[model samples]
Target: MALIITDECINCDVCEPECPNSAITQGEEIYEIAPDRCTECVGHYDEPQCVAVCPVDCIPKDPDHVEDEEQLMVKYDKLQAE
Candidate 1:
């Protein structure tokens, strides 16, 4: 699943640079992750980079877009292709 930043985000700007897919961006108030671009770091790392860097622990699995490991890999491949 793609990770999402909750309203609890402090907008510290730490997670943006850590994202390998460049999926995180500054929203109106908090940072947002593009679900289509988010592969949960499957292609690049063992774990989600954003989650690792986020101080507030606001980033969490996107319950609305759950996917298995194979699906995540496919998404990662598509992202790299683009």
Candidate 2:
């Protein structure tokens, strides 16, 4: 599943660089995670780096972009190819 940065995000600036897919970015109000680019670090790490580093523990699986591990890997591969 793609991970989401919730409203609880502290905007501590830790999660952005932790995203291997470069999917996290600053929004108008707070940080945001792009569902299309989020892979939960499927190909980059054993767990989501952003989640690991977030002090607020605001990153959670996105219900709107749920996908299995295989699907996430496929997305990772496609992203890597690009």
User: What is the C-alpha lDDT profile of model 1 across 19-54, one tens digit per residue?
Assistant: 889999999999999998899999899999898888
Question: Against the true structure, what is each candidate's TM-score?
Answer: 0.96, 0.97
- lDDT tens readout by residue for model 2, 1-82: 8988889987899989888999999998889989889999999999999989988899989999989999999999999999
TM-score of 1: 0.96
In candidate 1 the C-alpha lDDT for residue 37 amounts to 85
Give the range of the ten consecutive residues with the poorest summed lDDT in model 2: 2-11
Give the Cα lDDT of each candidate: 0.92, 0.92
Report how far off residue 1 is in candidate 2 (Å).
Answer: 1.0
Clashes within 3 Å, all models in order:
0, 0
